[model samples]
Every structure is written in structure tokens, then in C-alpha cells.
Target: MTDIKVDHIIETDVLVVGGGGAAARAALSAAQAGANVRMAIKAKWLTGGSTATAFSELLAIAAAIGHADERDHPEIHYEDTLDAGRGFIDPELVWTLASEVPHRIQDLIDIGLNFDKQENGKLVQGMSDFATYPRTCRVNGVTARHILVALGKQIKKRGVPIDENMMVFKLITDNDQNISGALGMNMETKEITLYKTPSVILACGGAQHIYKHAVGTSDMIGNGYAMAYELGIPLVNMEFIQIGPAAIKPSMTLLSGPVWKTKPILTNSNGENILEKYVPENVSIDEVYTEKVFPFTISSAAYYLDTSIQKELELNPTPNGGVWGIMPPGSEEIVQEKIPKTNGVLKAKGIDVFNDPFEVALVAQCMNGGALIESPDGTTKVAGLFIAGETAGGLRGPDRPGGNSLAEGQVFGHRTGQAAAKHAERSTNSANPEGKSHAALEDLADWIGRSKGKQELNDAIVSLKENMYKNCLVIRNEERLNDAMTYIQELEYSLENGEFNIDQENFSAAIDFKHMLTIAKSIVLSAQTRTESRSCHYREDYPEKDDANWIKSIFVTQQNGEMSVDTRQWPHHRKSEKSEVKL
Candidate 1:
């Protein structure tokens, strides 16, 4: 066996593997708890993760602080969250998020983060889709960016070390299956480093980029999901993915709250209003527009709006593979008033929404499911390893209320950080896992050495993305999902057989493609197992929500080197029934 050398070995009490808001907050909390924390990111600070990327004109952070509405409270938020989750949420986690997000928001404010406020110094909370009250707060349209910046400032002030452009590919575990450390490579220099830590936090975000059209940054290719799955962690609710409309032509920004209010004219390549064709006669286009916010959910008539755009793209796709959406004559005034930041962004890009028609497509937004956690502290079955933010699953379900993601990140990030710190303090340092690290490197070396063909990795990635977008997007069915699964399996086989060339220049991309393939297959398998239409996961073959049978969440896990699927009833299902809130 050929030996692969590790360039550096560093030790920390807690290692956070991500650059987003969750990772930043986790590092801050761990440091505040007196743990020596370090951060490693695949991209430069503030440019790689979903938290730093601008998705919409108004990215809301939901918390029931009663600043905007007196009736709003944590209990209402908890009930609303359960209702939106469709009985698939972890009630304890939901309560933790609902009750603790206000404190986390206060922490952000204490660290110099300012939310939008009214003239009287009260917070300007807005109503997000599926929410019962005005509970979402924002910083104009770029809420995530501002939150990340604030968290970054705190991380710096605490003197937590951050290693930029370090792509972690393997989680090194001891013979007992406890997390010992992690192995990563410097993207720029290709130098491998081993992180020796008693505790590790996985906050690497979601795998939305596996789809052709997605709102996530390119680096969010399911690093956390892939690593956890490799370590035999179960992922839940993988089928429930948020798909929504986004401008694809002039600029790739989410066409959410304010954009829908414009009541834009949606047309196909033939310049015909396509919404009228898809929307039923009983449901008017006006009603669809009113119900539409961002994601395509089955509970409202807005589903037809997204279906119309998707069908148009599949049938008569424009040059940009999207349908045309033209804002009305007087809607520019509304845009300016409602989404001034987005309006300026479009104007700067020479896209006059009121005058010219822009291309809009159904883009993958967020993954509601990921690595399953056992507690609010984001602890998985695996000891010494934790997950938070979009990387951790079971906190959300079928349809997440808008702005809940930001709150989840902060809430769980804080909990996971403190818990990991405590775990580190209690842990006794065992012998170094140098042999485990070598085994991981040997596996990587073997894969690279066996490559004898010349198939381009980029082409395979494009095909995977296109396939995922077509079959696994908002509208899904048995046949298409099976086909996608088959294709993914074939790709996996090809990769293992070394049909695709592995070169130094594309090594990192090859690793990312492998992770994407795994994630995409998990999504397809989960979507196929559900066999019902619910929230973002719509099965045309079933076309109905089966609460009696399908209310449970689907779980995917890697067992015996093969992927398996199973189902589990929500932990708080009975309790949820007792406290069910009727809208």
C-alpha cells in the first residue's frame, strides 16, 4: 500500500466545519463556553455558504417577540411551526427553537446586529407565508448576510481561529466510532491537514446545489450530509425540499414575498399566460398570486403557478430555460415601496421589472431534512459529533414556515456549541487516531490511482444536476423518481469503476460530485418511499396527502455499504394531536 502524508496536525477542543452563520455562531458559543474552537471553511470568509449569499429581497428571521403584534408569543409560534411541519417535527426541538430564538436574536442585537425598526424604535415584523402572525424580522432583503456579518464580528472579537479554503472530506473516527478528528485539504494548495479534536460540529449547510437551478451557493454540495452518511448517521425527511421561483435571466435572485405581490404576468415561450392554463377555473390567477410567497406548497392554489412555470420550461423552454414574467405598468412603484433593495439590485443589472419581461424558473431553495439529531443540542447517535443548522434534520418537516431556517440555525448552533464544549470538557483524551487517518487517505489514494478512463467530471455533474431538477423538483412521481434513482446508481457505479478520469485539477470536484450523487440518491429514494403528495414533495401518481399512513417521516441511512430507507412516526405525534391548532 502506498503511503499518503498528512501535512499538518492541529488540535482544538471544538472544531466547526463550515463558514456560514451556523458555524460562526457555534464557534462563538463554544469559545464563550471556554473551549478552544477553530473553524475550517471550503471557501473564503463571507463568500461561500448559504448564510452569506443573498437569496431574496427580504430574508426574514422569525421570532415571536411581540414587537409587531401583541398577541404573538412562543406558544403560538410553536403551534404554528408544528402545523406547518405537518406532524413530522420533533416537538422538543421545535419548542426549543420557538422559545430560544428570541434570546439568540437578542444575542445578535447585543453583538451589534440591527434589525429593521419602525420610527418609534419598535421592530418592523412582517408576516411570512404559513405563519399566523407578524413574526418575521428582516434587515431589508439581505437578512442572512447581516446576521453572518454580526456573527463573524463576534467570532473575531473572541479570537477564534478560522482556516479559509479548507475543504473537509472525511470525518476520522476512533475504533469505537467516536469522532476523533477530521481530514481536509487546502483548496488552493491541495495540502492535506488533520484536525485532532474531541468534539466536532457539522454546520456545512444543505445540498441544494445538486439541482441545476438552485439558490444555494456552489460550495453547498452537502458536505455535512455526505460526511455524516458516511459515518452511518441516519437522515430524515430527505424528500421534503423547498422549491420556489427565482429570476434567472438578468440576475439570479429569489422572487419571493414582494415579487409575488406585483402580480406579474407569467407567460410561456409563446408569450401566452400559462398560469390560466394550469390553474383550475375555480382558482383564479389573482388568488394564486395572493397565495404564492416563495416555495411551492400543496396546501394552496399557488402550486399551479409553479407547475405552470415548470411545465413551460419542460415543453417550450426559453433560451434561459424559464418562463417569462412581466411586471405590470404601475408595479414598479409597488416594487420600490415593498422591496427597495431588490428594486435597486435589478435596476443596477439593467433589468427594469416594470418594463421588460424577465425569465423565472422553479429553483431549489432549501432542504428541510438532513442528518437526524437526537436532541435540541443537535447530538446524533454518534458520540463526539454534532450537527446544527440545515445540516441537521428532524427539527423541520414537509413545509417549513418561511424564516424558520435562520432561527433554527441560531437556536441549534448555540445549543450544539455549548453541548459540544461540555462534551469536550468531560472527554478523556485517548490515543491519536493516526491509523484511521491513514486509512481514509489510503481510500482516497486507491480511488485516484484506479482511475484509467477520461470521462469529464463536469459533464457528469451537469447531467446529475439536470436529472435532479427534472425528476426531484416540486412535482415528483414514482416513475421519474425511480428513473432518477437508477441514473444516480449508475453514476455511482461508474465512479467506483473508475470510468471517470480523476486528475489533480479536478480532484476536489470529483469528491463533490460523489457527495452530490449520494445526496441526490437519498432524496430520490425518500421521495419515492413517501408515495403521497404533501408540501414540497408532490407525487402525481398519488396526488393526495395520506395522513393515516404517510404522516410519518422517511429516513435514509447507509448500512452494510448499501443505502436503506425506513419510516418513523414523529416523536411527539400524540402530543401534537392534543395541541393541534386549527387555522
Candidate 2:
């Protein structure tokens, strides 16, 4: 541990790291629980994260509100969620979320989140992806955006201190393994700031953009994942990431639901339907397009569509690294009404989705794995350290249930914030002990020191992304995965050994490159260890799910600078909280 002078010291009861919907909701919950909370964000306040820019009405938040149908309830939602996860989810956590999300949605409504309402004064809910009923509630196409707006207003009204442009670098722990505080750097001022808090909530989202082609926000690198790994927190299902065919040309928006509803024929540049050629004879193009609207699950045949599209891109080069998606006639009216956002975005790019063969490709959509947390409370193995949102794993399993991510942010965000605040109130150690922040400071210093004359860092990032897309995305096998592991290990070695000059001006990019590479290593390592195809983690070598051997979730943790991959079977036969409702 190196001795470094501190620039600024901030004392709070709770420190929420991130600026997305989860972070905001956590802050609000903490404040309501009568704790002083401070939120640190790397970007501009209330912008640039996944929650701010997510699209698709199908990306709706699931809460069994029973609006569309009276039979819809939490128990049914729980079963749907469990089925969507393929029975590998944390039963208690999934239960808590499925039971509590409707209440959280009501909380959002109280804070001015206006869902589309019906004429009879009920919230207009719709069915999407994996649900058996219309339980998803949304406001047009931008559900998460509006939820963020509502939560932001609440945080502002409660007078929570939000420090923008402050990139949190490390989580500080005390001698007893308790979270003492956190450290961050001011991006604009270039000054280090120490946050002395008893509780820290990590809502730092996912690291999906490690692949070259991804439908993630620009800053959606896995800093939280790296921090968790560095601090020895075990991650679950690290190999399971949702992948799907998305719009590439007119913007990287998801080309599901609306686009698929138009009966769009996915073809090559030569106007050849390739799904029939590559997918199993049992799967059909119409069924894949209609049934697999958004979520990319291996259980569903829709994944074949994504694989076929990717193969088309690789086999036949199209404009802008995308394939042709030709919609049938009368698509113009459907585009204007159902997919106004798609129409407007494509219209600006001089491509009419209704009349033209828009470019689309298989892209990295969401990560279903992250740092594992205890059920109902969102606490990690480390005391006073909690995780919420996409940063926390185990709530999801091999595949994702549509809209659960947003609901999770609200549900666990509220629970984690309340839990952290209560813990902070009971704790006495509010100050950072001597040398507690030293290791974190050393890393920050290392990042600063090595960031000089390092233009190759950008090249390394590009290479990492390209290699991940080539070896890890959509299709995976033993040979390609091994090659990826070798390349990544070499890059990690180079970064540690200072083999290349890093750009000082682009500190964020350098950090992003490291974090992305770290998560990519975790994904590849977990993927290699799990020798069976299940959910989103498909191995061509092991083409079928092996329940006898591979039914357990893979856990990846770091020990003595080396990765240790392990697995644990789902406990308690996947019993949910709402077990009263019979299927």
C-alpha cells in the first residue's frame, strides 16, 4: 500500500456509485430512511447510462399489476421469471423481485412516473418476450428514461448531493473486512476525492460493450465487475450474456418487436433467406421472428435467427457490417404508428425501414451475470457493501426475463438502499483507517502514471473488442475460446508490465479498456469452464444442456492474482416467495 495525499474528503452515511435509475432510486430510498446520501457519477448528471438511452416498448418493466388481466399476479410473474431464467436464478432474490416489483412500480407512480393509461383509468400494460400475460407496463417506448426522470425528481426534491463528473475508482475496506468508504477522481479537476461512508451501494450497470458490436451505452464498461473481482467478490453466471440481432445502420437500436412484427424478411445482399440454410430443420423463420421478439434465449428458436444473421454478415459482406432486413409491403403505416422512434431515427439517416432493406446484425444486448449478492437485502460477502442493478448477478440466471432488469433496479435499489442506510446507522466506523485507501490510491496513481504517451491503449481496446466479437459472441467453441483466452491474458500481462504507452488525455478510455478486458476475461473463463450449452451460453462443442453435470451456475473469483472458477447447484428446488399461487 502506497502513501498518497488525499485531495478532498467527503463524509456521508451512504455512498451510491453510479448515475442511472438504480443509483438514483437507492439514493432516494436511503434519504427516505433518514440517512445522508451522496451519489457519484462519471458522466453528466442523469445521462449517458443504459437507463437513460434504452429503447423498445418491449423493454418494459414487469410487475404483476393485473391491469390488463385480473388473473395476473405476483405468483404467475414469479413462475414466468423462473422459467425465463431456465431455473437457475436465486429463488429468494427472484421471489423478492417478483413479489415486490408491483409495489415499486406504485412508488414510481407516486413520484410522477406516468405509464400509458387506459380509458377506464387503468395502466395500459402489454405482453412482451417471455411473459404468459400482459404484465409489462411502459410509457410509449421510453420506460426506463421516464422512470429515471421520476427518480431524479425525487432525489432532487429530497436534496441528495449528486457529484457529477466524478469517476469512482475504488471501494475502500477496513481491517475487519467492512466497507469503510470509497475513492473517486474528478474528471475535469483531476483531483482525488475520498468518500468516508459506512455503506456503499454499487449500481454501476453492465459491461456489454466489450464486444466490438454491442447495443450498449458508450460508457457501459464493467468497472463495477473489475472492482468486485479486485476485492474478491465472487461473480455468478459470468458467461451468460444476451445476444440478438439489432439495428446497425440507422443507429444500434434493437430491431425486435416492431421490426419483427412487420414480417420483415431477413435476407443476404443477394436476397437469399439464410435461416432455412443454417438453422435446424425443426425451426422456421416465421416462428423465430414472431416468438423471439426481443429476449435472446437458447431455449427459444429465435436465437437461430441471430446466429443466421451473423453468419450472413460473415459470409456475405453488406454495407456497414450489417445484413439486409427487407420488410413486406404496408410496413410504412406500421412504422409510423407502432415504431415511431425507429421511423424517426432511420428517416434522419436517409433509410426508410418501410421501403428499404435496412442493415441489421447480431449485437451484444445485455449481460445476465454479475457480482453475487444476498437475497432480499442485496448485500455482498463484504459487510456494508451492497450491489444493485445490472452490476449484481444471481438475480438472473442463464437467460433474462424481459423487463426484469428495470424492475430489479427499482426493487433491489429500494431494498439495498434501505438496508445500507440501516447498516450505516448502526455502524460506528465512518472514517477511513490508515492505509485503507492506500491500495486504491496506488491503482489510481498507476493509471495516471502509465497513461502517458500511450496511444496504443486505444488499439488494444479495439483489438480486445474485435477478438471478443470473433471468438465469444453468438457462436463459441473450444478452439476459438482458447484463442480468446490467450489473447486476453497477453493483453493483461502487457497492461500490468507497462508494455505499451497509454494516452494520458484519455484516462477514461484507458480505464474502460482495462475494465472491459477484465470482464471479457471473466466471460471467456466461465464460458470455457461450463461445458454445456444452456440459455445464452452456447458452446458448439457441447451443443446440448447437460443437467447432470452443468446444471449449476459458474462462479468466478480472483485469489492471489489468479482466477478460480467454481460452480454451485441451485438451492431449495427453486422455490419462490409467491409459492401460494399454484401454476
Candidate 3:
């Protein structure tokens, strides 16, 4: 407690709490609209958020895919999004995203987002599976990264105040539920920051790293999700976990997604394309693989590697799940380099993905749903608080469409910022009823400083990650979940014995991993309760969708350190007082 420091104060009309594509755009939009906005990021600005991991990182992704002419209105986009989300989406929320997506795409282009174009200046496009039109778009192949880079420079040009390498411990609100601001524990000096503002926006990204082996970065620990839930917010789709289909011995084959045409034939170690035995006839090649071969593990897993089919397969998007599809040119190299990164763990476990694709397993990648903050127009049940990008719900279900999330960041972040500003302007609440900001900051700073126990943080996290990889990814059953829950309990008990020493940067791996454990518990709990398979939550007991029994949303909220899950019935889409502000 003595080591704690209270460093600074940041006040703004609107506070954007993330640095990714969505957060950046949100801040820029708000600031440009004359709102005094400040953004805070937990890690290196864009690096920690989802904008860094998009498929192509292109601007106007859907436009590049095919809707270059605005032929697709928000209504069409809304229906397509709702359909993809499989009834779990918030009707009004989907309406919001769909309605604004097209104009937002145009806004990116207007702001110097260099999307790919043909000789005639028409947008270059392709179909990345299941899209209503050729909606998959790209510029340099990595849409997420490209957008991050561009948005990075774009925001830097605007000179927004940003604080990085800080841990936001909790959301602070007055008794009236008006968001006064947030409290943060500085990683460097163990001091805390108390922010008093009209509005608070959470742009914190997904909770994928909570699982053992993940393509997601270390910072992807559901911190934002946890904070929102702690504040009594509902997470829309907590059960939808996205797992990539390709792995060579437990290492993901990033480039392999675009290679080897026509769903590589699944072959066992015996070099047999296992599709022959179980894949029923009449299914499309994509269906034959994703719906049939990919799920079944015959003695491990089997996959056909045909370099010869590269051209044919790349033409048809192999990563058919997301809005971002594999673009040509870099497919082989991306696959080649990324596939081997999984070696250390796989080598330690004795599996070779190249020689045996089946031997390669899974690590966690992304969670499609989370805490229900507000729509782009920042108004949660808890007013004065807003959610952005991945932290806010009603965007994706268990399975997210590619390119859509990046778009989400732009649209919602901006909306939330503006709405928050509007709320602040209209609200009659006082900033501080009893001066809690300073107290809250000091308390958090002290708490962060006091984590000086002597348990091995890294080892426990590694174990947690490994356990999650085996139990939670791709294949899951009740027994596995139960075992994992028990294992996590013992691990948590052991963490109390470790030596923390309150080193922020030095002990970030520990902090990151600890947060992962917390988030993993929620995921497993939600996954365990659903008892049925749908989209990303594929339970062996309930392998098929039963709309009659499970047609609504899975609302998971955490209270009193316990996660409570409930089923929300889908409501008819209603249009609220639609704002007149259009890009």
C-alpha cells in the first residue's frame, strides 16, 4: 500500500477507453465534432485491440467485396448481420450497425483509407463465404492491420491525448448511475488515476488470451468485458468462441487458409482423405469440410495438403467464417511463417502439424460476444457510460463475420462518443456528490501495490493456458469443462502464494495471465450452461440448432463474484429517436 502513487488527472467531455480502429475513430470523430475527448489504452495503442488482427485491414471492406455502389442499404446490411448472428443479436443494435455501416465505410474512404481499386476506379471485390454480396475487401491482405496503421496515423494527426501502459481497474459512477469517470492503477509507479468526466467509454477488446494457446496477443484478457459486467451490464454473446480451423501440430497455419483449393481433403496419419468415410454426398465442398471433416478427430485430426490446389482454393475463401478472407499474393508466406510459431508448445508435446495436420490442435483466438454496453449511441441501461467495439455487445454472436468488427469500431465508437457528449450536455447531475474519485483512485493504487505474494505467476498462467487449450477449444464436453473448473480453482488458490512485488511492466505477463484466468472462468461457465451446439458453441450433446428451444440470446452477467446466466428472448426491432447526425 505504501508503494502506491497517485500520479495525474485527466478530464474530458468524452472519454474513449481503447486505442484500436474503433477507439481511434471514435475519438477522432468526437474531437472533430468539437467534443473535448481523451482516449486511454491499456497496452501499446493499436496493438492490443482487435483492429490489429483483421484479415485484410482494408477500409470499406464490404464495398471492396461488392457493394461499391451503395446498392446495399442499412436495411439489407442489418438483415444480413442479424441472420449471421443467428437470433442472439439485439434487434435495435443490429439496425444501428446495418444502418450506419455503408456511410461509415464511405467516411473511411473520405478520410484517406486506401482501399483497392480496379483500373476503372471501381472497388475491387471478392466473396469471402456466406456474404450476401462480394463483401470481402482488402488493400494489403491484412485488413485489420492495414486499418490499424492508417487509423493510427489518422488519429495521431488529430493530436488526441492518449495514456498507455496503464491498467484500468474499474468503472466509476455516481449513485445515480451517471458515469463520473474511471479509476486506473498505473503500472509503473503502482499509483492510481481517478478520471472525472461526463462520460466513459470502454473500447477494451476481446478475452481470447485467457485460453492457453491463442493467436490473440497477451493484452486480450477480457478486462473491458469484466469491468462492464462488474458494473451490472449484460454480455450479449459470452458463449461464442471463435477457433480457427487450420493448425499444423497445434500451431495455427495463418497462410494456409488461402492455399490448397477445395477444402484440403482430410486424411488420417495413414494418408487417407477421411472425408470418404463419413462426409455425406451432395454437400458443397465447403460444407463437406467445415461442417463434416473439420469437427471430427480421427486418431488426432486429418487434413490434406495439396500445394497444387492453391490457385483453386485461394479463389474460394478458405477462412469462410469471417468478413476478412484470405487474399492472394501473401497466402503461402503468411501460412509458412505463422504455422511454425506454434512449435515450442507442440514440440514439447510431441506433435508435428506439417507432417500430420491432425496432430495439430487448437488455441483460443477470439470471443464473438461480451458485455452489453450501449449501441454506438452510448446509452446502456446504466446511463452516462458507453461501450465501444468488442466490449459492447449486439455486434457478433459466437461467430463473427470478418471485416465487420473493424467497421463496428468505427461506427459505434463514433456514435458512443457523440451520444455521450450529448448526454453530458443534457444531464443535470453534479460531477461529484462526495468526492469519491480521489478515494477510488487511491484504493486501486494501493490494491495494485499490494499484490506482492510469492507464487509463480508465469508458471500458473502457462498451466492455465495449456489446460484451456485442451479443455475449451474446438472440442468440449461437460466432463472436460468440469475438470477445467476444478483445475482453475486449485490454480487460483495457488496464485495467492506467489511473489508479485508490484512490478507493472516487469510483471505484466503475470497481470495479463491473471486476468485471463478470471475471463476464462466466465467463458467456461457460459459455455457449460448452454448445453447445446450453435455456431461457436458446439456441444456434442446438442450438435444441432433447435430454434424452438434456443432461439434467443444468452445473457451472462457477473454479480458478487459469481456469474449468472439467463436466456433473453429476442425482441422486435424498434427504432428509437433516430439521431440526425450522419457522416
Candidate 4:
């Protein structure tokens, strides 16, 4: 077989890989910094990633704008973030994110993001389950969509070139382990394109789709995480992922505060309330149900709500294959007001939240982990490579505050864009580019050309998702986590034996299979190592958060095709004494 050649080559000062809110913000910021930027997306520009499809209770963009509460400052926001993280996040990163978020929110407003406001002209802020004040800013619930639309308009106005339907396959690095360019393949034509640039920003989002019950775009299979891991970048917080109840049968929409406000009784197939039996007798069940915390959190009592449901699922497999949500009456207005997008989903399914008991289950939602970055500028261990959004982790630990994820994207996206431009300007190699990008494409094309697709490969992928959900999701145990490891190792063995094929039609799926497998293994590995139960990572055997011993984070990196996992203490032992915000 001949070496596969790149069909097209594009040169830019910086490359942003993703089309979500973070990528859009980064691209626009880079262009504003007078950098020639090119962006590649797996789908269309604005509506392709998780930001566009987010359908939970009001998608939050947390910023201490002091709209609702004048006392809601960055210090309070930073404290709340630390409390959510359970001593696992870097204090500096959290401080940086909280400090800059208000400015980033203002930037979004400048770009035409119409945030909901009160009659007094201040932005209307609301509270999630865990908040010192109302810091979550939203637009009737579609915060992500509106943010994307606003950033999309800015990118369009700035004239940044966007390559749609182009899936970035790998990052090309020079001999010094410095990122030089990237290789991508057009989804429609399967032709390879090489992007030559000094800087690459990874906003490719998270690996929530690694589970069978996932809530993000299908394309978010941790491509960024896998590429960074393969390139020897250490990833932190792989064990921590957010899960929440979402509609299962009618359609997948977030069953958030409003849905729970209807006093939905979680029942088995026989219509018996299941949660009463599992929750502690001392805990108030009403408060747990009305906690307004969508994500299953170990730090709060609401976690019992999900644990009880999981218990029921194990004992009796329901006819619908999920726990039934018997929503109380008079919820129509609340549903419409809180989650307008979910209202559409319910209407399309013909199951009114006011009338019917819909099937709801705990589904994997947001990933709070990714390639570790050392600075607020989103600089990764790999030079010339940066990351933001869910693709970067440092500000979040065992869990995240309600709106911090989206806000982190905006804050760091702006910094990364400017940083990439400066790096591009400082780099000396501009006239003559290397062929490593083409070489990477040739390797990928060679793998794609050789193999015949197999049904077993697809089945294996399904099994991977099932194993992760069963063992590594909301509830986990030592035995089950070990079982997950075995299954992942066996799948890896199959890949080594050439049992799977990379046919053109299943090319992306096959590639995603590899990424998901790696990411799943890492999650299970990290979960198994962390003996204490903290936040979303609940271990049944280790049913306590051991702050004395488990306050540090586990960092995983790869060398010689093997992963090395180690622990690192949080940099700061105490909060900063200064009360003034940095920005």
C-alpha cells in the first residue's frame, strides 16, 4: 500500500479545534488579537457541540456580576467553587476563573448575548442547589445556546475561516514536542486536510459519551482528551463526571428543579415509591427531592435520590428499563418557565410534564476533567497547545459549581486566544513548515484503508459503554470497577489482535472507539485508585470522603505507550487574604 497524502493544506497563525461556545469565543478572540485563525468542527459551526444541545434546567453561566446580590463578589464565588471541589481543585485556577468570569460575561453581553434581566436593569440571577448567592445567569434556560449564537455572530463578523464537517484526527508536533499543526479529515469526503500553525487550542469538549446513557453530542467522545493523553499530557480529575436525571423514553431532556418541583415520585414498574427505603431515616426526603441540584452529588443529600433509583434498577429491571417519574399535577407553567427547551422535548414526545409519568434515568452529563493546564492562559504541558471549556481541567475537582463550566470557557477562551497569538508571533519558524502534519495524515489514512468493518467491533463499543455506566457512574464498587478494568483490557487485546476494522463509513466511530476505550480505562483506573468517596465519584466500599488522605488529585500521563498515575497536592494551602478581584 502507498503512503496516503494530504489532499489539502491550510496555514494559519492559530488553529482552534471545536465549534462549541469555547471554540467560538477562542476563534473570535484570536481574530480580535489580529491573528489569522482557522477553526475545524465535526459538524456545523454553532449548533454542533454540547453548548447548542444543552437541555438541562436553566443552563448556567456563573459569574459574580452582583446583579441579584450586591454582596456576590468573586471571593464568594471562589469560596463556593472550593467547597464544590472538595479540596481537589487548584486554588489559583479557581481564583483566576472566578475573577475573570464577570469580564467574560460582559464580553458576551457586548457580543449581543441577551441575558435575562430584572425590572431594575440588573441581570436576573438564580441559584442552583449549591450556591452562596444567585450567581447563575441564564436566558430563560438556554444560556449555552444564546452564548453560542452570540459568539457565532462575533466569529462571523470577524471573518474567521471555519472548516465545517472536518474532524481533527491528531495534533502534529515537532521534534521538540512543540505543537506545529494539526491533521483533520472531512466527514463527508473522507479527505485529509493539514493545518499548519504554531498554536492549537483544544476546546473539543469532554468524554461524557463514553457511557451508554450520555447527554452530550454523539461526537464528544473525548477526542481532545485522548489526543492529549497520547501526546504525554497529564490529565487530572478523570474520575469525576457529573450525572443527572434526564428523560429516557420520550426524549432526553434534563429533569431539573422545575421537573422535581412537580413533586415527582420516583417509582418502580409497580408504582411504588422506591427512594423512601434507601435514604437515611434522619434525612428529609422532601428536601432531597426539592434540592434543585440536578447533578448527582455526594456532598449533598440529593445523592440519595439517585442511589435509591440505582438500587431499584439493580433489583428489578423495569418494563421501561428505567425508573418512572410520576410528575405531580400543575407543573405545566413551571416546566415552561424553567426549561423552555425541555418543554419542547416533552411536547414532541406527547408526554406533558403536567399529565404523564415519564421514564427518567441517571445519565452521564458533563465531564469536569481533561488535559491539565498550568496557567489561566490554557497552556498545556505540550508547548504551543492550549485547552479550554470541558477539554481543560484545574478549576474543577470532584464536582463543579453550577455555572462555572460555561464561565470557565469564556474566561480562558479569551486568554488562550491572546496567548496563542503571542506565541505565534514569537515563534521563528514561519516560512518553511514541516511535513509532520502530512505524515500524521498518512498514518491515519493507512490505518483507515487496511481493515474490513466487523459487527463484533460495534458490539465491543456498546459493551464498553455499558461497562463504564455499570461500574463507573453515579455508584461504583471495588469489584465492579475491577471488572470494568478487565473488560477494557480485553478490548485492548482485541485491538492488538486486529479483530476490528476501520472502514471509511465507520472511520470516525472506529477512531472514537479507540479514544473512548482509552478514556474509559483511565477513568476506571483513577476511580479504582481513589479510595475515598468524594462528590460524583462515589465508591460503595469506600463510603466516605477522607479529606486527611485524599485531598490531593490524581494525575495520569502516558510514556512508552503506558499510563503512569501519580498524586499531587493542591498548590495553595489557604485562600488568599486579599479581597480585591484581580481583573
Cα lDDT, all candidates: 0.87, 0.81, 0.61, 0.81
How well is each residue in 361-430 modelled by candidate 4, as lDDT tens digits?
Answer: 7788888778899888999878899998899977778777788878888988899999998899898764
Write candidate 3's Cα lDDT for 162-218 as tens digits.
888777766778887777877675566655676778777787778877765455466
In angstroms, how far off is 190's CA in candidate 4? 0.6
- Model 3 misses residue 16 by how many Å? 1.4
lDDT of 2 by residue, 1-583 (tens): 2234568989999999988888888999999999999999888886767898787647688888888988888888877887766546787887788888888988988887888899998888888666888988888778898999889988999999889888787788888888998888788876778888889999988887888877757677788888888789988888898887777875786776666666677778777877767778776767876666665556777778777876787788577777787767766677666667766666787886667777887788778899989767899889999999999998888767778889999999999999999999999874554377766667656756654444488788888988998899878899989999999999887877666675335555666677787899999999999888887788989999888887778899998988899888776345544433211
lDDT at residue 500 of model 2 (Cα atoms): 65
Q: Provide TM-scores for the models.
A: 0.96, 0.93, 0.79, 0.94
Q: Could you tell me which residue pairs clash in candidate 4?
A: none
RMSD of candidate 3 to the truth, in angstroms, is 7.6
Q: Quote the positional error of residue 413 for candidate 3 in Å.
A: 1.6
Cand. 4 TM to true fold: 0.94
Candidate 4 regions off by >4 Å?
280-284, 329-345, 430-434, 445-455, 573-583
Ranking by lDDT: 1, 4, 2, 3
**Model 1, 126-205: lDDT tens per residue?**
88876788998898568999999999988999889999999999998887888899998899988889999989999999
